[model samples]
Target: MIYNIYFDEANKIDQPGKANSYYGAYGGSEQTMTDITQTIQRMYEELGTKSELHFREYNHDQHLKKYFKVLHYIINQDVNINILIVNNTEAHSIAEQLNLTMMELRNLFYIKIPERLFYGVTRHLHGQLDVNIQIDRNDEYDALGLHSKIKEQMNAHSVYRSKRYKIASVVSEESHESIPLQIIDTFMGIVVFLMEQSYMADSNTTLIKSDLVYRFLSEGGNVERFIKQIKLYSWNGNENLSELSVGNYISQFMVYKARYDVSEIAKLQAIMLKNPGLLAKEYRNLMEYPNTLTRMLLGYKDEVEGRGRNYLLFQ
Candidate 1:
């Protein structure tokens, strides 16, 4: 039987401060890599239907072709196996290069592995939004089936939870007043915009824009009015103010005035999520918090630090 597996490349070796070989470069503790891998594996087994099927994992340390070799050994004859590769990055050029490199591997494997036994999966992973779907290459059945399956799986999986407002921490003795309605409205608009841009990009695409939008709202100010002011001076005069389009403009602004402290907190959370080793330490910090902001920020920080840090580092 040709086993179809989804392939995603992650930098498992820790080097938090070193530059990424691909995507935006940065360096951090190897802890981040370990955490993400565990999360994915646990999530897959806990969430995926065919949990027992080996995922055929690989990382930057190994060349793409080396992975194909393992597949060749598994499939010698008329068995059919399909695998999809995933990564985090938005630049199409990067994805294309990875694909080309994979093709080179296939060529090498053709002599070693049966061509009939190995065919690329019809779909791949998106970098930014982390959405998975089959590529729409005019193949109706595969496209439809894959899209439906991915959607179904995501809806069913509770690997992570989402919340509306991000809170840092609250005192048990007192309640922090909710953010102004105007600010929340503006912040939500930015999220809608950022998420839109992210959806249009690759699955590995970092949610940098979303983070920026969140930060913009997080700062104390007349949120909507400030956004409107930013829009007025922006090139298109509010025409590009949707979540995705606005991200483009605001991203530049963030470069000039982004807060590292908040971003650092976000990064810390990302690290905790990926590295279960750090979870205990981080969870303890979180448990001490009396409010949702602390919990949410901690969670958000882990993801940002692990996956989104590079993007937010300078900005």
Candidate 2:
């Protein structure tokens, strides 16, 4: 069977001190692309707007209602969805160990996360299945590099080498021109939003509730099942970094950034001891609120650090 995988990404990959999370989701099936495209086109016509459907633009009540309907329809399809969410702190620690620059780390993740997602999607298949991967084009890197990386990873895998699965091609296209890509984009937006909420809740940041998201979560079992299929991965340093306190990790990361004066790291370290989440948020307004860092430190103090493994198949 020839399966077409449409992929899209959300959130920044290499933000050093940002609280935002990263996600990539890809969905695949033989006929799902065509079916979703026609349904979305019909939705556009019915809504009396020629604009493309983007989840980020779902702000107004009318748009949210329409988007919820669209999501319901798409979630009911037979396509398989796989998602990857990165643990930024652990990823940063790994990048530091490897001496990778921000851009290099970004490129590595661009390849690694998606490759992991693809592997999870096809790991159980024991028959011939030709997979064609289509990613939304982004100028951060060229299509050739991504294509090469994906091919390399796929060929290196034992299952693929056994001839049960074949990578037909890895190509990039404009999201606006690909209906399947748009559907994946919408799905990723929902996933990213939920992740952000979880991050904020961990950080003790104020949570913003979305009725649309709640509706999807409550509508039926499929969306919840789809979410359970998401796989999260992170590169731990030589040791299990999650076992370390947020303060300890920050101090270590600061040592790596020794180019910055000692006073700055000291000041940040002191603040982290008191208010850890503040360290995760970008230095902007002087707002001091607990965030992920706080949770990490508390976890350390309770001797329950690393309670949750970073990479797991969502249950």
Candidate 3:
């Protein structure tokens, strides 16, 4: 089977700052991907889907129903959704500690996001699956020969050593013309807005955006399932990968998950081994709030791994 992946990013990852950055990939079989575009067109006629599908242009009063229809359809399809969230402050600090130029570190992430998105989607399949990627037009990636450079690296991934998947082509297209790009762009905006907690601010725009997000997740357990498909996480330089790799050092990514203090983790582990039943009943009874450094992981079903207790109160 052949796959066509559309890529988009939110936030400036290269620039040094405290804010979080995000990159997203969304696509699937060529037929499925095309069907999504056509499906939205039909919805446009029936439900009056907005002509401008970009999330930044969203108006709660006019676009909520239309956007929700698109969002609902996208989530239900058997497509791959992968997002990379990066902590900009941590990245710059890592660059300083490793004595690498800011440009050098930025170059690494520019490649890793697409590489991981490709891997995250195609890793499970074992066959000669032809993969093509189209990135939304952006300044950061708008350089001659960059597309070929990315294509070469993706085709060289170790996961594809068994001839599992081959990168066919990498191209850039305008988001306005590309339905796939616009779709991922909206999803990217949602993830970034939520992670930044901008919704907590008492602003008219924030309130509208919050309402849209809350409505998307209004159904029971819908949040967990929706979040899972996206695989939204980060590479914050927590662990070093400088010496482990052959070429330049790349920051290892840690997926989004809850985080408790060391003492709390140990205590929870003890409980798991002693009385597994009690662990469930009192797992929410955290002694102190979860560590604020990482803001904890979200949508955890259980504490079997002792990875954490409060998933940043995501529940």
- The TM-score values for the models, in the order shown, are 0.18, 0.65, 0.70
lDDT of each: 0.29, 0.57, 0.64
Name the regions of candidate 1 deviating beyond 4 angstroms.
Answer: 1-212, 215-253, 256-258, 261-263, 266-290, 294-301, 309-315
Candidate 2: regions farther than 4 A off: 158-163, 198-209, 222-315
Candidate 1 lDDT, 158-204, residue by residue in tens: 23333111111111111012111112122323333432333234221
lDDT tens string, model 3, 1-315? 888999888777564454777778886888898899899888888874448677776644345567766777787777777777777888878889999987777677787768776777777666678888998876667653567877888778845466578888898998878888988888878766656656557554654555455545543454555655676546677642221121111011111111212444566556556666653325434423232211221113233354333332333
What is the C-alpha local distance difference test score of candidate 1?
A: 0.29
| Model 1: lDDT of residue 185 | 25
Choose the strongest candidate by TM-score.
Answer: 3
Q: Highest lDDT, which number?
A: 3
Indicate the worst ten consecutive residues by lDDT in candidate 2: 306-315
* Residue 159 C-alpha lDDT in model 3: 52
Ranking, TM-score, top scorer first: 3, 2, 1
Runs in model 3 lying further than 4 Å from the true structure? 14-18, 98-104, 158-160, 238-315
